[model samples]
Target: MSERITLGKTFKPHWVWAIAFGSAIGWGSFVLPVEWMDRAGPMGVIIGLWIGGLILSLVGLSTGFLVKAYPITGGAFTYAYLAFGRKHAFLCGWFLILGYAAIVALNASAFALMIKFLVPDVVKVGLLYRIAGWDVYFVEVLIASAVLVLFAWLNIRGADATAQTQFYFCVLLIAAATGVTAAMSFAPETSFGNLLPLYKPGIPSWSAIAAIVAISPWAYVGFDTVPQAAEEFNFSPAKATFLILAALVVAASHYSIMILATGLAMPWLDLVDLREIWGTGWAVQQVLGTAGLAALAIALCMGIFTGLIGFYISCSRLMFAMGRAKALPAVFCRLHGKHGTPWASIVFVCAICLLAPWFGRSVLLWIVDMSAVGISIAFIYYCAVAYRLFKWTPTQRAPAFCKETAPGKKLIALAGMLCSIGLLGLLLVPGSPAFLETPAWIALGCWVLIGLGFYLTLAREYCNTPKAEMDRLILGHAAA
Candidate 1:
């Protein structure tokens, strides 16, 4: 009976073990610096180990509660569809693809930059060609593009390989980061007090609040990926939620340790410059010397490679689903009969990702923000759907978590939506000063326009026909 289900049961119903871990490291690694700078300061950086450790666990606990209640392959997209009609579902899915793709591109680009940094010889002919009294790396596009391709290929080959590689790399990263921090903290030259905050600052000031708001809640970004593996988990909601919560705790611990070690080892000024923030290779070099750095670089490459593969797999699946719905070219919906993979969609997704890095110098940075904003919007839509399910949907049953007409569930859902909406709104504000030059609103509008156009085209015939004629025609056609 289960074999006849629409979802493939070949793969066990386990939360995406590997993808989740990769996302944790990839998303949390960079976010550590951002969060450390804002919430911890120099002292906050060191103390972030303890404070952030606690905070992330709480967040994981909360998210686990919700995720257990709803487990579906499309993540929040599936939830939105069930509660809200097809229109809301379509937008959420579209935005999610855009967001995840952007993030994958950005991460690839960053990985490339790190590679060049660790091995100066990787790029030949480094000359100071001063353009307006500034030196820029000339081979930016070549390096990043190469990284994207390499990762995409790795992902297309297999999922199991990707998972194993990521698991090992994660272990190494944690080890290397730990070693660096331990040395820094214990070194006679190092003063741990400098890394400690004077006080908690009682209540945060408006300015401080603004900084936190602006910093982006990256700590919470990849939680959406949880639901996408609904069909793959091996447990009930209770068990799945437990696993998710466990992963988050481990992830939080790993990141907090790294941030603390980094703060203790490097000066505040040293850490502030994004360029100075070394990739896994350079970071290892600084702590463990040349040989250590080389080993770390290899590990870093493996990690990045796996990340690319995971992104390709998930995004292609999404695109394939969309294509099947005729939201995209039907060609993308075609699958490899033997391999059982969406080979066409994979190629298309990888090709699109390859092109994104060509958007000039700020490609990586822009990609992250673009993707982040898109994901936030998608989350807001999800929250809206959840609320609707709890409110308007007469047939909707309360999940195990939210059973009664409890005001608390309503508040949580409302808060989640409001928070997501507020961030998305801020991103879209034209006059609002932000990190990027292109207005967020413009980018968002473009995505919306493109998605809506496809949707209207797919539903055009039905939308144009009158209700009486459609009913009569259906009846006549059936009788015939």
Candidate 2:
């Protein structure tokens, strides 16, 4: 195998925690409270989301178990290849790449949305065309594009710098959100009574709760990001699963706090029906006046930036692994000599997201709805690999890390696998509340078609390479 560089060990435990926690929270927790409440009531949203978090805890543990078994980059991609083969790896990477890219774009476009709300006239300059009731504007696009470039550059700079930045951003994000939650508690206009009509009327309380639980896969996605950075951990591999599980708890709490805090600022029913571009922001403004809005702005911006950085790190690292394995053109395998970051992959992700702002807000909502299915597919594959390898396969074939595997780890893997499938059914089934709308279906279809074209082109190249050689490239000389 031709020699290739690897990412260095620079991530501390806290840094990995920040990446997972921050990525999982994102801007969704801050901005989507109103929408989440609309789907499920305020209390229902919190209960269902927490329930989803607990479910995803199982998935995160399964993923972390695999991280220890492999201790390599590429995350689910590497796991898929190990469990199946090259073609499966390509399929996994194809789905994951879109999920990662769409999220980066989703968060980037969200930053623009926040900016538009803060200074409506400021970002409204030079209005462009509109898409699905969302007006596209040059200044808003510029703001979003600029942040995309900035984050891409930071990621390419090095893992050390990027991880440190993520930690501080994560801290500020939590603090900002907590500030609003605390203010809502003391605000004269707020009381427990404001939380009345706990579950949306006409919808069964159980159904409302189950509806949000179904979104657990997407809601808790950032926890899996820990595996993508396992290759760069300065700590022991044994600590990975704990970090992921802990991050999920924090992420779920952060989300719940935001939802409850928003709901308390005003009667949730009144808050839910508002047509304001940002009822969440507007609600916060009402509670603490401008100070509350400022805190929210800080939280939203930090959420966007950290999510952008965390996922870019994951995206570039996944592509780097795939490229090194010859699943992608080797261009992505190249790293900066000084920083040891995947410069090419970062640039590619940044370039794709740069167009997101121009696509308008519809792109943000549609892509997220579409990407959830792709990432859930990833969850299925990862858990399948775990179940097959640790349970059914001969024990001798297991990695050294698996020698002391937990008693019920296999069953947990099975549950994770089934849960992911349920998540898919919830979104794709005809009558489900979480069903993708027409635009999302169309967006998802385009991504699959694009992936198919790329796969056929690369199939010839993948075939020419032997399995042993591909393993060496992807797992390196240390691989058994």
Candidate 3:
């Protein structure tokens, strides 16, 4: 069988590779650790990210294995269906959609926040004040929405077109962020000694390490998103899985190095009023000063643009897959007449993005809480499935990229399970009076509880009723 399949003018490997890089190293790596580092301080942030990154490595590898086994587009939802059952699969899909949608909203909110920093004066005055809040930016929202529409069109027009865009943008973003950050760090005023024993006083306990570790995984968030492009890989899923795992390792290293360099240059102590002092423009100004600040704005604009495109693409794929499997309303699964992309799903995602403005400053916190738990649930599920597969499914002659699912497999799965569980607990801990106060964990619990309530009331038929009838009932309700 030939390895490649055409999706519009888009080539194979291109889309997969683009998403692999973009999804793994998007705004998440660039911005998340900065926020978390402020909380953990430099040393705690470093150690927590190291441990959290290791946990993500384990999950990423397991996801790669699962993708090789079944390289479908729905990611963990696909795996959850086969390993668990339809009910759990639906829950997985629901949470996955919610998680990614939260990401879109988060990015848009970040975009607006960045704009407020860049042009705070104009936004605070006269006509701008009437529409957008004082330092509340809606211009960025409009721009982000426009980008979403354009990318949606491009994605439908040709997968290749979208992939090409992703590749160039990914390279541009990585190089820009890295180059400017490095330039800023190497300035004569920057201290090499600031890297030593950087600490902040807070609730310092071994218990807090777990909390730090819980939050730490946010840096490694999108590593699993690579495997979502499993169906588009040119190589066998086996080889593709290895490449993805390697990417996670490289990405984690890149993040660690960037933070280390940045910490040395602009120690956490000096970052107390980082937001008010540096604002969203901190990263860029750290290197280029005024000239650098302009460049930083340009880079963030691009970063947000690319992030939206990738987010829409992935979420659309997910919704499309669910619809195709009759797990969601069939209309969402519809393709464009000429473009062959999931038009309905893309539109739905855009509609969802409109709600982004409501989140305001709390966007990242919400995304962290929304993503951490749902993803952890998926990770735990994958671990369980891998455990069962290792025990029940005999290993055949393996592909070179496939690791031997020996006793080590079980151990790794166990470790992943424990880590996820522990992190989930720590993340749920309420922030103390002195710390950064975010209500996302509570919000996520409320959200999940609502989902569970819906599951009990309406979705019970999905589990109890006949398959055909269940699909019909589910679709009918979703459509209604």
lDDT of 3 by residue, 251-347 (tens): 6665665565456555655654455523325644664577767655555655666666666777887777666555665677687877777888888
Q: Candidate 2 has which clashing residue pairs, if any?
A: none
Tens digit of lDDT per residue, candidate 2, span 1-480? 578668888899999999999889887887888888888898899999988887787788888888877788898899888777778888888888888888898888888889889899898999889888888899998988988998998888888888899999999998888988998888888887888899999999988998898777777788888989989998898899999998999998899889878888878888877867888899888878898999889999999988998899999999999988878888998999888899999999999888778888876788888889989989898888787656443554565324344548888889989988888999999988788899999999999899888778787877678767777777664334
Q: In model 1, which range of ten residues has the least summed lDDT?
A: 471-480
Best by lDDT: 2
Better of 1 and 2 by lDDT: 2
In order, candidate lDDTs are 0.53, 0.85, 0.60
- For each candidate, what TM-score against the reference? 0.75, 0.96, 0.82
Candidates by lDDT, descending order:
2, 3, 1
Model 3 residue 161 CA deviation (Å) reads 1.6
Q: Candidate 1 lDDT, tens digit per residue, 1-480?
A: 001112343333232544555565563354335334544364444343334333333334434444566544555555554455456666778888887776677667666556556565664234435443333444655677777777666655554455456666656655655665576567665465644442225434333333334324343345445565554455665555455555556665655555555554445444454455353334435555676565545545544554565566667766655554444566655666545556777777777777754563344454556666667666676666555434324355654323346455455566667666766665566643233346444566677798778777776643344434432222111111
When summed lDDT is taken over every stretch of 10 residues in candidate 3, the lowest stretch is: 1-10
Query: Global lDDT for candidate 2?
Result: 0.85
User: Over 4 Å off in model 2, which ranges?
Assistant: 392-407, 477-480
